[model samples]
Target: MSRSTLWLLFAVLAVAARPAAAAFPADANPDPRSISVSGSAEIKVPPDEVLLSVGVESRAIVLADAKRTNDADVAKALAFLRASGVADKDVQTDYVNIEPRYPYDSGAKVVARLQPEFYVVRKSIGVRLTRVGAYEEVLAGLLANGAQYVHGIEFRTSQLRKHRDAARALAIRAAQEKADALASELGVRRGPVRSVSESYSGGWWRGGSGGWGNVGGGQAMQNVIQQTGDGGNGEDGTLAVGQISVNATVSASFAIE
Candidate 1:
């Protein structure tokens, strides 16, 4: 009934009539229109250096004899490699194993007959080649010096990060382009970027027979010269027919406008 009370009620009614403003917790809020796309890229480059695994395996009746024979051959290999310009540090040992050889007689039976007939010891060395063409000569030299066990060889390049980035940039561009095209087709414009991701794979030579253990063995050495070269072998031991590839994937989400 009072003017002051009526005025206060009118003010309250006016305030209540106003629309409620949207309210949400930070994480609960979401942008409605968004698009996610992924793209991939690949690049190929020649491998620069070569890695060779060489070793010596010897078998004898006594562990001492086996170890002595293996050590002698390993010394010869290291000396030959050093003389050929390979650094002592570069010729690192990968593994050394000494074990007893078991004898199995006729009928798949474990015959305990006689003393342990043989002891086997193997010593492996890893060689890094800056000059690819020198591989053949190195092989021959090692062989002539009684370095008999040969492991497989691998070709690789050191510029991995550079090549990977190049591919990744291309992939990101591709994803952006695709997103733009999709936006155009859907009659929408690209808004702010929401998220991004990537993937990668690769690093292996194309050819070679048998495992590293078989490479330097007498039977395996017969084909060392016969191994097919991807690229021509030069005097420096550079087998040029080297190619490596890297792939990059980019997954991005952009707001739809």
Candidate 2:
């Protein structure tokens, strides 16, 4: 080994011995120890709108006849809805289905006949009523005009976003209160929030009955509190204007000092 070779070898050894640089510097202010807690809140408000699912069904030996009759009934229903103050944008044709109907034997098997007996046509319409008070009148009018099958009805709140925000605020407050209570019980102090997360769930509930039936259609938490409000009928005691529930849940971690 010559002097230059020895010098190169020494340099390489020194470089190898040196510690590698870190990708990032250590956190100057490390996260403090945290206490986690979750809270939920529910707000009940009278529904401001109603959605009614009305269907018209027709059957005939000929497919065209069935479709024609169904179309006429659907037209009459739409006109009635418009006259009852429902806007064009609020009324929608949900679906139209056409299928062959076959005669079945007592054993629930298709009769030996290979050809279908008649054709069945079904048309479903969705009507949205902004005025909760007029739901009954509109519903009855729809049935009398052309609608035959009542698939389902749902009551909803037009101001759902506003109510949800309010509920979230309440849930956050509840979480803070819960954290404070736990800290007090453990003889420790609660510090600033270290982290926060949230979730939500809610639906319309009829008085005495469970949640409203829909036409087409979380992790376990402890220390949860729930409350419900009463629902009543309209002024005329005819329509049951159920209450819409807006719920929110918040999970918060606070520094323990």
Candidate 3:
């Protein structure tokens, strides 16, 4: 090859061999001298509302009959709820299931098919009660009206977002406190926070407050307290609406002086 051609080829190869230029600046690693700490805090508040889960199951030899029976039964339950002061807006249908029960013992293969010996229709609903005092009455009435099963009752509050925000602040404060304690133990002064990271959605945390063990460093945890119901007479006596917990965790890195 000619000298000028060889020189041009070498220059082009050199340019291609070089690493591609970055469109944005690369992220620098955090300060090595800084210490990372995580902290969590929780607040306990009395529940202001109760969530009740109720369901109905009906079965029949025909699909139409099964659906009609289920519809009628669910309407009866809904009517009972509305009459008992539950608004339409508060009653929500959670699920509707249509399943077939086959007679495996019969001369039928275990293949998946549409037709079956019997059709079972199931409907589930959620009821939100703002008044905790009406727990017993509602529980009993729901079953009497047509609810075949009562899944559970959980305590909750309307101000969940508000409590979550407060818990986050407490978490940050707890992180600062942890950093300060560690610095003191090492006989080193704690400097300003180098970086802080927090999850907006509080994590599921331990249920209780004031008696917390080593529970922190998570986000968006919900604690559900289930209240069991006995089928006897559907008479769930006055149930207590326990406290609800809001938890938060904060992770921070602070420089050392």
Candidate 4:
């Protein structure tokens, strides 16, 4: 054969001898040699903000009268919250609802329900206090100044994203350590990360139920007058500004070599 023809023949033979690439990627199959691990982290920090849910309810024979009384009480509550150093923008109405209340008597026979005797007007407001030092003061004044109900109060931090990121980092570090330990025990080396996922929780975890002091509802606020004092102190002891716990968990998988 001619020299150029021989070179062409060699190229053809080399190409034919080369291994063919697989149709599917290497990672398409389950990594039987990989190890999966989970890690979790928890951090406790003080809350910098306070959220108070306050409401006012009024009833009267006339719907207009009921609404007017409710508006007046809610207005007073708003003003009280603002005066307690809660900014105007932070104190706003959450909801307004009006319903008819019927009067019924339990009789021996036919118990005909009387027509609605009164209309009930209810309005609730939410206040976010950036200054936690005034949390108790705002809670106290809301009830003292016409606020008929205290739905609940929550302590949280406005810097939620910052704390959550910190927790995530810690969880990831823990996951890496765990994977390294497992791989070492198996006498294998860790390869590229196959998959990773994370979940986090924080803020408003400890919520009060029912109403203020976990008492039934708005009617219960009437009896809480003594408890909602400016001192933040109760018969037993002083207020406890507890810390909030933030947690993050991560699931990671790595291939073993």
Per-residue lDDT for 81-179 in model 2, tens only?
888778999999988788897776666544455568899888788877888777777777777877776665677777788899999999999999999
Q: What is the TM-score of each candidate against the true structure?
A: 0.73, 0.77, 0.70, 0.76
Query: Which residue pairs in model 1 clash with each other?
Result: 132-237, 132-238, 133-236, 133-237, 133-238, 134-236, 134-237, 149-216, 150-216, 231-241
lDDT string, candidate 3, 155-255, tens digits: 66678888888989999999999999999999997898888877644222223221112223111122233333221112244344445567888899999
Ten-residue stretch with the least lDDT total in model 3: 210-219
Which candidate achieves the best lDDT against the true structure?
2
Regarding TM-score, does 3 or 4 come out ahead? 4
Steric clashes per prediction: 10, 0, 7, 0
Q: Flag regions of model 1 displaced more than 4 Å.
A: 1-28, 105-114, 203-240
User: Candidate 4 — number of clashing residue pairs?
Assistant: 0
- Candidates in descending lDDT order: 2, 4, 1, 3
For every candidate in turn, the CA RMSD to the true structure comes to 6.3, 7.5, 10.8, 6.8
Query: Could you tell me which residue pairs clash in candidate 3?
Result: 202-219, 202-220, 203-219, 203-220, 203-221, 204-220, 204-221
Residue by residue across 40-146, what tens digits does model 1's lDDT show?
99887666666777667788888898898888988888888989998877778888887786766665445564447698888777888777667667766876775
The regions of model 2 sitting more than 4 angstroms off are 1-32, 105-112, 203-237
- In candidate 2, which residue pairs clash? none
lDDT of 2 at 220: 10
- Most TM-score-accurate candidate: 2
Residue 31 in candidate 3 has what lDDT? 48
For model 4, residues 85-163, the per-residue Cα lDDT tens digits are 6778887787778889876667623444556778988877888887766666666678888776778677777778888
Candidate 4 lDDT at 146 equals 79
Residue 181 displacement (Å), model 2: 0.9
Model 3 lDDT on a 0 to 1 scale: 0.71
